[model samples]
Target chain A: MNYNLPVLLIAIPILFSFLSLILGSFNKILSKIILISVIIFNIISGICIYNSVLKNGNILTVIGNYLPPFGINLISTYTSISFLILLYIVFLVASLIFVSKNDDRADKISSVLLLYLASSTGILLTGDIFNLFVFIEIFSISNIILISIKDKKLSIKGSLKYLIITSIGASLYLFGIGFLYGILGTLNLSEISLNFDNISYFSKVFIFLFFLGSIMAELEVFPFNFWISDSYAGSKNYVNILLSGLSSIVALYIFIRLFLTVFGYPTFISFSYSLPFNVKTLFLTIFGLSVIVNELAALSSKNVKRILGFSSASSLSLILLSLSTGLKNGVMAAMLIAISVIISKPLLFLSSHQIMKGKGEKNLNSFIDGFRRNPLFSILFIIGVFTLVGFPLTPSFWGKFLLFISATEKISYTTLILVIVVFSITIELFYYFRLMHKLFIKDENIKVEKTKNNFVYIFSGILLASIIIFFSVKPYFTQNIVEKTTEDIFDKSGYIKSCLKSGEIDDR
Target chain B: MMIDNRTLYIYSFIIFLIGIYGAITNRNLIKILVSLSIIETALNIFLVSTGYINGSNPPILHSGMKLISPNSINISDPLPHALVLTAIVIGVGTTAIGIGLTIKLYNHYKTLNVNRMGDKDEL
Candidate 1:
């Protein structure tokens, strides 16, 4: 019951966001210092919460001293705390890279980054559904602003599309919340889960549909992610790291929280005599199509940023595909894949910008003789690609291996999914290897600028790569962590009991 | 039309569908933004309506009212009203951001038609 950690984790960054803005008006360097200090504080708080969770098992903080089912609450389980820690690390690296650049709008960017961190952390920690909606809006608005910070025409258009579509999705989500409130009479997540079976069959199905449709946009699944490539290509490279690395992880975590935890299958299976359609199968088909379509699109795309964007989307789909299996092992495999993606995607993005520095074009042609220009970055990029393709001695390899094992163990149509995954992986390999080959191809006539190496970029890239390699070499450590997280996610009764017990404390 | 609880839900649903239809069919960026606002309005109405109790008084306590026990008085649920207030504020913020983006897009392309903007890569 370390009361300060959860509230401070959310409040500190938010307080600093405004503080940084005012401080930036006085001195820009002061604002940057505040941003760095906030991130460092976030890391320390994240570690403290992790330690508390290890000792005390899931800390639930009730806001305003009101009992649960009435007051807003924040819960930090092992899974959420792990994601928070990972998010802090990525933000630390991204902030360092941002400070290294001498952009005119550094103060503005620092404010937006802090707000982004605060809202996303709020989304992860809040246990109330309505609070989740508020956080989602903040997250989306900040994301749009972040995308449009460069004030370029394309970035504006991209952010416009993103804003309009995601706003509509948020409205749909609010509508779903209305229905849930009407039926369940409470906004607390665990309270809703406890009373979920009391809802009528039709209402339950509709609520589930609304939630799925709303979240699918952020998840970057098929039908709602057409704007993703544009946004990725239009924004600055560090923003891409946020979009691909940090935000996507949070989005997936929210999806898991809603689907696997809130409207879980265990509750549904008991109340309903028979389901009209298989929900898991439906999710599987959507994710399957997402994987194929995104990978194929990446294959045809010539823009370097767009290709990486599509690859990130496809990786998200792969994680979703594994999660739809509803087996413990599937959840484990999904976590494994998600961790590797969270690690390597940002590395690739950071290094891609480095490799494309001083280049006029962002096409594959720009990558020619990349190895000659900066050998360290070229090697880092190759390692990133290899990890993405799940080559041996990379963390992604173990993820894919565990995924294949888990998929074969419990899923129907395993061969069909296996084929789709393998086929898509091969297509991905073709394009990635082609890029690697272009990097090695000698082009002496290409005058590459000998740009000074940004220590932040190189250090972050090398750090992530080394982490990936270390995990690959000793995957048992990761396996044990993922196993525990999976158990935490699957323990629905335990989650409810803990939340309700915390809620009951005030009454006694 | 008699406006009962069920009827209110029906009206909101139809409005929501119209918003969705408009959002899908409109080519102009402003029209799309309007459609999104309409959707938000529909949801807000639905949410506020959920808090309504038939013939119940507004949620308030007057002086000299003695509370004997919980549920002693019939009052409409105030939680959904609070939620709707927040929703309306958020809706305004989103609309403002959308309008800002629209202005920027119009200034850049000199047109509001979504189709005419062409591919972002080509821009």
Candidate 2:
């Protein structure tokens, strides 16, 4: 593979999204075919990029013939490539369900999903600050369209709220970008990082605050996450995968990528200057509150989607808390938890979607006699919830284990965070088991129609389940990659050098 | 007299604050969207002003201009101008979507006031 593969990974999906829309106008099946093909093509390219990065150290593809500092560039490092692979895999499974299900606007949905794929690819790969902003705008706009596609009152309401909140977030981010550009006179992330220390301390604080406001909304952290439950409750199941599974992971990736690389302290990156405050402690406090509050919220909620929404939020906070430990092990733990969430949340959403069919209400009671109706779905649901609650064989268990081990190492807030974590886990276990219990509860005197499982649903379920089981059986497989990714994230000099080393990769 | 960069920054900041105040105080969805647009415009103004250089020409080279060294080309930075263009397009797209959602909500609820919508459920 050539160095152009990084850009191709972004361009192909965008090209295909438009193609699918134009073609799907003629025939609906064409859009489905295009979505699958585009995703498959992306997966192949993602693997190639991964291999190329592993072999060639890092691949930088400069756009528009401009050198790295002046032009747009895509950097495919170990960290980004790994996340890209995981994202495409999730997209593939979600597309399987998306393709199988029929909707009046299937063509539009296909195109939007394709655009989402492109925007996410851009988010992962781009090295330019302004380019990142543009892709984020596209990502959120497409997200708004997807959430309200159902056209129901609740969905519209949720989408409207999401629109308002995200618009504000995006605007704040723009203001931040304006400030940065005004001070730094360059839009390139590496160049900015190189000159970050020259700026005044107050400017640094204000810029970082702007970035925090925006990322907090996108990251769906506690205070800025009011849009999530309502939006998740109102969106379609696969879109839930897009929101909780895809977007949250991407947002967290953004949080890590930007914060660690651009604004990281000297302890993390030798050249980067330390921030005025302790970011780790701050994140811990905020994320700890998010964990406890979200889990309690989940425990109280009865709507299945809202419960799952709260659960996903709690898992995201748990991942963030692990990240806040600011240790390699903490990142590894975060990866473990993130992987578990990316796998299990989709499984839960898809299975619950199948189980909730023909039921007027979306609640835990909808799962009564669920096993009798759709045995495969119920079993999958059990495994998913079990994985979430940190069953011993699951990756979440390993994640929580690693988190506690790291948390014990000489942090001032150790016991406090541990207590909060323990309390959160206890609540999680209670509620998830309560949900699983409802799956097997016998409903008397009701002759329930046996719900037929679509082959596509079963295929996707098995595919997702085997991923969880594979990691469960062998946790070390992903641990190595996560370790390398953590190293890649910390290697700020290497990132800057690769992006700034002009035309060497191009000759190849 | 040509406005200095500090004056431009302060003005834009005030405009941004006004937008934020409007967004926070407004109960109507359309009003909120308009506030968002105002915020976008303020940011764009701030961004474009960041590229400003007093008495400098627009970052353009026409045939009538005498050939000069690269350092001698007295022009404002063009990058933020380009950035503002992109931001404007994005702002337009976001506003369009916001309006579409507002229309849908109004058709469903027969009211535009956010508080008039149904109360939040326990879920």
Each candidate's iRMS in angstroms? 1.5, 2.2
lDDT scores in order: 0.84, 0.85
lDDT of 2 by residue, A1-508 (tens): 7778788788888998898889999999999999999899999888988888889898888887788788898888898888888899888988998899887788889999999999999999999999999999999988999999888777888888888888888988988898999999888888887888788888998898888888877777777777776788888878888787898678877887677778875355122336788777777888898888888888888889988988898899889888777776777788888889988999999889888878888988988888888888888988898898788979899888988888777468679778977998899889888877887888888997889888998999989999999988886787787678878877877888988885454664
> What's the residue-level lDDT of A318 in candidate 1?
90
| TM-score, per-candidate, Cα-based | 0.96, 0.96
The CA-based lDDT of model 1 is what?
Answer: 0.84
Give the DockQ of candidate 2: 0.67
Across residues A214-331, which tens digit of lDDT does each residue of candidate 1 receive? 8887778888888887798889888898989898778888888888878774431121112357887788788999999999989998989999999999999998888877766667
- Docking tier of model 2: it is medium
Candidate 1 wrong stretches, greater than 4 Å? A265-275, A447-449, A502-508, B63-66, B119-123
| Clashing residue pairs in candidate 2 (N, C-alpha, C atoms within 3 angstroms) | none
Clashing residue pairs for model 1: none
